[model samples]
Each structure stands twice: as structure tokens, then as C-alpha cells.
Target: MPGLGVCLALAASAAAPPVFVPVERFTLAWTHSIEKVRWEEDYAVVASPTAGQPPVLQARTARVRGSGAGMEPPDDAVLRNGWYEYTPRMGSPQGLRLTRSPYTADYAWCVDGQCVPLGQWLPSDGGVTLLTPCARPPAPER
Candidate 1:
């Protein structure tokens, strides 16, 4: 992916200057507050369809345990070990906005089988966090 120089930009509502994570691919994982089911979505950084646009997140796969409420698994999704796995219809999004709450566990930013609380990188303070693909490495935080 030469010329991509891509990274994931994590910007909290209050974090004027976002902290970036250098990754070509990663997963955003979390557990349901009520159902306690694990949900994970894998994403890859790829060149945008437009000729000169920055890279965008191509959602690769999505998996979750159990289905109810807003967690219904697609009919084509396969079930194994109580987990439903399938490729997401999401082609690419300009960005993803996650609502951070103090009650539930923080979202997990997983890479290379390592999962870390996103709070470790940027403090959301019960605010919203935006994730998007960046064309540059993050600048050193002040």
C-alpha cells in the first residue's frame, strides 16, 4: 500500500488534536452492556475509490454472539460456538462515531491479537469519539 501512509485517526470530542494509531488494519470490539455479547468488526485501510481522496476504512468482517434488539444477525450469517460471523455490507465510511459512556466498558482497539481500551489512547470523558483513516502519521502530542 505504498503512498497510502495510512493511520487510524482517533479524535475525542474534547480532544482538539487527535491521537493517531499507525495501523493498516484493526478491529473495534466491545461487549453489549445488557446482553453481554461480544461484538467485533474488522476494518482495513484502502485507497479511496476517488483518484486523489485519502484512504478510507473498508469494513472486512463482523462477528457477534447472540442476536436480539438491534443485534440481529443477518439470515446468511453462519452460527458456530454461539457466534455469528459474516462479511459486513459496509463498503467504506468516511468516519465512525462512537458514543463513549462511563457506565459501560470502553471500546477495545484490537491489533495483532492485542486488545487495549481506547481510553488509553484518547480520553473520551463520556463524549463521542470519531475514527477515520489518515494520510499522515500522528503528530507528537503536546
Candidate 2:
């Protein structure tokens, strides 16, 4: 019976699929004028509306298991404005969704309707961070 149990354990281990865990997801939104930036730590967040224009910026980040294959850590550009979709090793048919991207750098300042390039600007710490509001897909023109 002990031998049978061991066999069963091995079989289960072999059959077990992979699993994925999300590190975190953050989102930042800025108005077209780029006057102010709003941040959301998780999904389904509603930011207080600020005076600005349309064309807000959106960013997302996620840690995936099998999906990370061949994909390198998100780059600055990706961290700045990339939509991430992660797939786990095993479990549900639909994997977790880190709908929002975390701020990569620690500091974010706007000037003349543009986010200063990374490195050029500095947050309290050297850490990276993101800034913006929730993003919606472009609407179909009438």
C-alpha cells in the first residue's frame, strides 16, 4: 500500500499543471493636456475627474508563468505603455488579469503636454513609477 501511495503521488505530481501568481497591477491616467495624473492600484478603480483633455495614457504590468516563455522582463517602453495579459501553468481556462500597470519609476512629472523621459526625471527614490488614468478602447467613428 505504501508503494501504491508513492506511485499515486508521483502520478499526481506529473499530471499537475503549472500555476501562476500575480505580483501586482497598477494604472495611471493623464488628461490630454497632461495637467494632472490619476493612479489606480487595482482594477475597477474610478479616478476623480480632473480638468483636462481627451487622449489619456494607460499602462499595465503582470507576471506570468508559461506565458513568460521567451519574453523578457517588461522594458521601459512596455512599462510605460504596454497592455499585459498573463497565462498561468494550470487552473482555470482564463488566467488572471493584471488590468493595470504599476508605475515603473518613482517620480513622474509633466511638462508641456509630455511625460518627461525616464532617467531625466527623478522620484524621491531611484525606483521607477507610472502615471495615468483608466483606458478605454477607441470608439468607432460614426
Candidate 3:
């Protein structure tokens, strides 16, 4: 019985958590007007504290518009948001797809509804590019 107990402890240590921590949150801090719009597929980079753990890739869907929608806009409104979690096995090759045009610079990356930096913007292709100046590690919370 003692030997079995030891094995169980070892096995449990190797398991990953069912949910990951939400490091940071942000809202639209700034906005930029683009001359042209393009629809591209991108990935959101997330961090995990566990060592030897791979970065998480979340799917993101975004849309931009020249003007804001009036009261009770259409279901396919000009603006939309989606959140995703990271998987260790998938790595960064797979990310969310953005199916909108007129990409506006006004949209900002955020966590928990707060504005964050460009570095937080993890590319779906496994590239770490800092899109903003206020890049910081995500807090240890949901």
C-alpha cells in the first residue's frame, strides 16, 4: 500500500492545471486610423508559470470600422471580441483567425478589461512582437 501511495503522488505532480492564470487586463487605450483594412488570422500569446510549459495560443476575432454603430447595431456589428486559452501541445503554429476589414489601430490589447502593451499581443505564428510601450508580466490572478 505504501508503494502505491508513492506512485500516485508522482503522477499527480506531473499533471497540468485545468485553468491557467489571467496575467493582465486592459481596455482600448489608444486608437489609430488606417488607410486600408485587411483581414488576417492571428494568435494571442499567453504565459504559464509552469516550467517547461509551452506558451498558450488563444483564438482572436476582431473587426474595425470608421464610425461607431448606433443604438442596437446589427448582429454582425462592426466591432467584436473573442477570448481563448493556450494549449501546450499546439505550440504557436495555431492561433485565432480575424475575419474583418479596415483594421483600426484604435483597438487595444487588454486583460480583464484593462489596456496593455503590444508585447502582450502574442502572434499566432509564434512571434513575440511588442505592439505597445507598456508591456508587463500578467498578474497572478484569473
Count the clashes in each prediction.
Answer: 0, 18, 21
- The candidate maximizing lDDT is 1
lDDT of 3 by residue, 6-74 (tens): 000111223522222233222223332333332222335454345544444433443333333232223
What's the residue-level lDDT of 22 in candidate 2? 17
Which window of ten consecutive residues has the lowest lDDT sum in model 1? Answer: 1-10
**Candidates 2 and 3 compared by lDDT, better number:** 3
Model 3 off-target regions past 4 Å?
1-33, 36-53, 66-107, 117-142
Error of 1 at 119 (Å): 0.9
Cα lDDT, all candidates: 0.78, 0.26, 0.31
Candidate 2's C-alpha runs over 4 A off are 1-50, 67-70, 74-142
Model 2 whole-model lDDT (C-alpha atoms): 0.26
Candidate 2 per-residue lDDT, tens place, 1-142, comes to 0000000011123353222111123222222122223332122223224444222222322331211334433343133344333322232111122121234433222332344432343222222223222334234599
Models sorted by lDDT, best on top? 1, 3, 2
| 1 versus 2: better lDDT goes to | 1
Model 2 clash number: 18
lDDT of 1 by residue, 1-142 (tens): 3344233233443436656666788889999998888999998887777886788888899999888788798888999888899998877877788888999999998888999998877776687787878766534599
